[model samples]
Target: MAATGVSANRLELLQIADAVAREKNIEKEIVIEAIEEAIQKGAKSRYGAHHDIRAKIDPKTGELALTRHVTVVEDDWRPEDELEEFNDSALVRLKDASKRDPEAFVGKEYIEELPPFEFGRVQTQMARQVVMGKVREAERERQYEEFKDRVGEIVNGTVKRVEYGNVIVDLGRGEGIMRRDQSIPREIFNIGDRIRTYIYDVRPEAKGPQVMLSRAHPGFMAKLFAQEVPEVYDGVIEIRAAARDAGSRAKMAVLSNDSSIDPVGACVGMRGSRVQAVVAELQGEKIDIIQWNNDEPTFIVNALAPAEVSKVVLDEEADRVEVVVPDEQLSLAIGRRGQNVRLASQLTGWQIDIITESQDSERRQKEFAERTQLFQDALDVDEVIAQLLVTEGFATVEDLAYVEAYEISDIEGFDEETAEELQARARDFLDRQAAEQDAKRKELGVEDGVLEVPGVTLPMAVALGEGGVKTVEDLADLATDEVRGGFEVRNGERVRVPGVLESFNLSQEDAEMLILQARVAAGWIDASELPQPEPEEAYEEGFEGEDYMAEAEQLFEGSSDAGAEAADDASDASGEEADDASAEDR
Candidate 1:
């Protein structure tokens, strides 16, 4: 066929397609498809907008074909609405269509050949726009596909621009953004500067594919260490956990698979070469490389290095630990602005409370006295017997009543007969205590519906009743933090105020379950309709230069008082009625 007036040579079309595909980093087929669509659009404008125009290009020969499709239908079957959708030039009746082609039938489509028209300036511009838009879309798809799996990997880029603390990076293939908060604190970048960052996320957006880079993320530090240390790269040393205060300090726990290789020494390298390389890249951030241990206490002790730990008490139910350090090492263990203990907690996945040896001793003595008094009052035992029970680690009447007779008998100065008598008294006292609490619960007018909620113990109900949360609706109206344990401002410092369930010594999981049940009972939602709470992101530790010596002194002085205050808060939450019964029983 002869070339049309506006048609390019077949070789030119093939060359343009190849050049555009390479420039856009997209498949050649995608570019050719876009070219075909643009030609089809131009053809429709030339022939008639209402006519169905299609175009195709041969991959091998670059031959172009343009055709106008005419649908054949019965004259009577053409509804007015359907006829309005087409022009007379686009549709043909079966009988009339068969005149042009001897065997045309209803439901058949006939292709009509037409000479290509010359392209006008407006049509050429429109075709250019269509090709550019399609190419852009294809480029974006290619960018997303290329970088999606690259998330969590480190990439090197040159700074393209810095806009309001956010750095735009030219990542060789595509552009990436390092948001202001994602960059290490106080770290600066200038245009054309070489920077390395972790590709934390890749999102396809309307404008283009968004690549998110981060330097402050803990994973970024881990990746840097893996890059610097050969043992880490080879899996001989594993990075168990890492916590950072970006641009200030970081803590990483490393475990060695081979017994001969020391994890911490390997990470540090010979003469501190490996860790120093990572530290320099992070803008002089101090890093602590510690050996990881399977035993939690040993791991925690290692995490809080440069300080001697006198004692470590684990509260498994609460997932908290109490670390008692020597008086001289208090400042070191707590670090500047509590950074050491906080990072240790994050690395170990536990809440840590650090106190000095003196504070721990004082707290222990006060606890001993309180337990002795509690046992004496609840079990109607003498001071001598109470002391013996306390010394045996029986802190409550429930503990005494639940233990085997032989276990209690093993206490110094206690025989099997005395143990049996103590057990009986303990059970009787508990029964009387429960009866009294039930009476108080009724007197406070706690709703029966609130009582029916699962996980709501009698003590929790009594506390809720006293707090004016009388019905399931009232309970459901409480916020999650309020139901769990809200915060309070004390001496201008905000601290958590133990909630109703916490006052009863219930676990957080139990409290959440109670709240969920209350929500269901209040007709607020079905059990299946509850939304899962999103996991909280780990916050980077912040460092401030504080007077650690003075702060440690203050913490030591208030350690026992804080324990007493918490106990008093718990007592008040359970109601004044229970306190009077205990006083009378004693």
Candidate 2:
């Protein structure tokens, strides 16, 4: 830092290092090391570039020293960068050093003290750059260490400047940039204005560590509530899930561990004071404080506030829920631009499909009619008989075919002979259908061994064959995402791509089991290598959603919680294994 050609002074250099260390918020030792390096660079320029020039600064006396070092290295040792040869000036071979001193070791260094020299024009500029570069690096490291763990925390800062549409905030210890997309829509701020933001992510970059700040993140609202609601801060109440249509509306599900305290009222406060405080900070984003229910349907209903729900049907296999609302409550249930349903979906962790009662009824009737017609054609039964079978809850001809004779005979106005005749016809139709499918499957070049894979049905084989998978090996090579369906980037946008078995509505585990079984059948793996199935109880304990249902194989056998846990665990394992196996196999 001293100017070129200036006389070296002890106290001035230490004082300069102390001031720079304090200003940069770095350790004084680091500044001293940076100064030593700068002096070394200057000395190297003055002497020869080939010499190993070294410099050191005393922490207390600020005494400066310069020296040259020649290290003794083994003759056969080569540097990591093979392109560069060892320098004889800086490095001496052990063979040669041993000759100079009988007991010389490989690591022994020969040091020679040099006379002090003044910095030149080029040396001064080089020293300044070296010092600045090291100091800046230390400062960046300090900032990263200070702020990396502060993510997900709300911070108060002043608007330092704006670049394009992003705002740069001075956070006292470091700087944070709230990108345009992370800021609340329509919110405005000027230089020197105080603002609040949530630290969402911190990433180390070449320029510096990036502290990504956001006001629109749901965590920001949750933190604001924590500040305003003591119950939340004290953990008496827990915010289970939160979703935001940011700057427009948000939904937060809160639960009280204490049975006496209502979570919704606590968050809403007396006369809405608590919720209002949070809303103000969020740039007038509407907040809905809802009670969290372990039951997913109830929670989803609560999340779609001001909209009444008539019914909810959850497809555990799909992680989707079809909600039936009253005809008049359609708009309210869906919200503007489907916001209500979207937020409810996010809060419940279910894909929400909203429909009106009329639509649901129409769909039910259409399904009933389709089933009725299927029986009429397949069983050669009259419309009245098919309608009677449909009314009795026979959804498929297979149900009638396999069902006990008593089940059909017990139907009003049905005789034992009639039930038996109906079953025989149903069986014949299924046999003919299977025969047809087998013929078509053969035509498509599907191997019969594919049918031996666990869980592969006739229709599944047909579908697989149509999908260009003709053998067991082909089935084993599929990824779970390919089987359960996944997205594809098409023309710069993500589009849904259906899997071969997508229409089967198979759960992720079912797909994996299918593939794993196929792998065994194809001799790609051994059956003994398959994971032992865990009991359904394994997942039931820590299940998060309220709408846990029994395993699809079991008809409402266990509680919903128990069922979902098993499904999720299987799905996760299957998904991971499928990805790995397919990556290798393909």
Candidate 3:
């Protein structure tokens, strides 16, 4: 049997091991091992023994024990060899000699009672520290594993502390960080505030587990809607798009697959009960719910809700929309500070320009007036004739000359017979005017004659006019290939200048003129094909040199100072009469 009776009280060591295991929640076996190692170390440090020692606690009765193993030394062994030999030394000494023990076994177990041990305060404190550190490490690992996969979930927490614009929330299992940017603006959070936030992210950090929470996240709004609106959760309604000026206003488009279910009405609930709940959660931020649309113009019109749209002109090339509204609805459509239209633009992915009814009418009128003025100045038309043309829906000289008599008769006042007569007289006048203009052209040695063609299109005319090509001479000067290509070539791969003609919905002649104008503007043709301006015949023919020369000679023969003196005398007489009249009245 091993000699264990002399070791420290076995019961006390067992008690300590049991206590540590329970306190640290560690396995009893682990505590038993730790106790044994500690006892072994303490024995070696204090006993000065160069022998193998083992320590153990009795599992059943809480008893502890230790044993020592030593070498056998012969009586005749040297002192050094006697102590050094682990098994046997021939010339060494043994502490106890028994001649009766004839088997001569030497380095073996010796039974001796070791003294009882007492732990100093320092050792007890050291043991306590070791157990605590191990426990803490285990706890941290447990926590990290618990919260690693819960991001995007909504969690309820109590506000613990506010520090430097950050709020620390106390979740039951672990703490979460609510950063300043994640909190709703203007929201006041004090200690003990019960708040729910979305788990924005879960990341491992140096201190422990990191759980990031956010109240301002877009998903938070979606989650709130999901909770309050049964249709959203049940998949009957879908949020098509959302745009927010966070903390103030937000716009969302909702659609319903079930034709009977009104998505907006469902989300709003009865008298706005559902939406109000979401608003309260969002710190009273205003939300606008608009009906989602599949049609682009209709969708955009709905997106800018509360503002009625009379017409929406979509410019596909620019990805823009021109919205026309009545004058009274313009301000409402644009909204205060243009917030409605701006958010609508963002929602619809189109640049929107809102124009009122009156503004558009005024702009059209001004454009017509400008075109009339330019035509009148170029044609040298009499004012009365120009007014008549304008009243008869032929504002410009080009319109009067190029439009059919039947078209003029269709105007309010004129019948077909009157229009025909008017057309004949105008034609006769134009013929005479053209002769005079041709005579002047001959005088200048310019053979290119300006004449009007009713068949030419407006696009063709504008194309020619912008190019500074006036008559058929200008048109003939352009290369045929260049003229044909101008009508077909696209500018910037998307915008065909000629494509604008179709958008006008103009007549065939107007369409041709549009193309012609574009070609002329591109410098593919000359203006000589277009109508030419009349000659300066009236100025030349109306002048009588004889009368003007007679008047000039008379002025030269008269006294120029006599006229000046007469005007001076007349002014003095008027002043004297005014003074006499004032005296008579007095």
TM-score versus the correct structure, for each prediction: 0.74, 0.88, 0.42
Compared with the true structure, the alpha-carbon lDDT of candidate 3 equals: 0.66
Candidates 2 and 3 compared: the better one by TM-score is 2
Q: Model 3 residue 77 lDDT? A: 51
TM-score of 1: 0.74
- Per-residue CA lDDT of candidate 2, range 1-586, in tens? 6564324778888898999988988999999999899998888888888899999888999888788999999889898999987888899999999888888888999999998888877888898999999999998898999999999899999999999989999999889999999999999989999999999999999999999999989999999999999999999999999999889999999999999999999999999999998988887898888999998889888988889999989998778899999999999999998898889889889999999999999999999999999999999989999999999889998999999999999999999999999999999999999999999999999999998888999999999999999998899999998888999999999999989999998887788888999999988898899987555454444332322323332533466775565566656655666688789868
- Cα lDDT tens digits for candidate 3, 260-281: 9999999999999999999988
What lDDT is reached at residue 324 by model 2? 94
Off by over 4 Å in 3: 1-152, 172-176, 200-212, 315-319, 363-586
User: 2 or 3, which is superior by lDDT?
Assistant: 2
- Give the candidate number with the greatest TM-score: 2
Q: Which candidate number maximizes lDDT?
A: 2
What lDDT would each prediction earn against the true structure? 0.83, 0.88, 0.66
Better of 1 and 2 by lDDT: 2
Candidate 1 residue 578 Cα shift, in angstroms, is 38
Error of 2 at 38 (Å): 0.5
- Give the range where candidate 2 is weakest over 10 consecutive residues by summed lDDT: 544-553
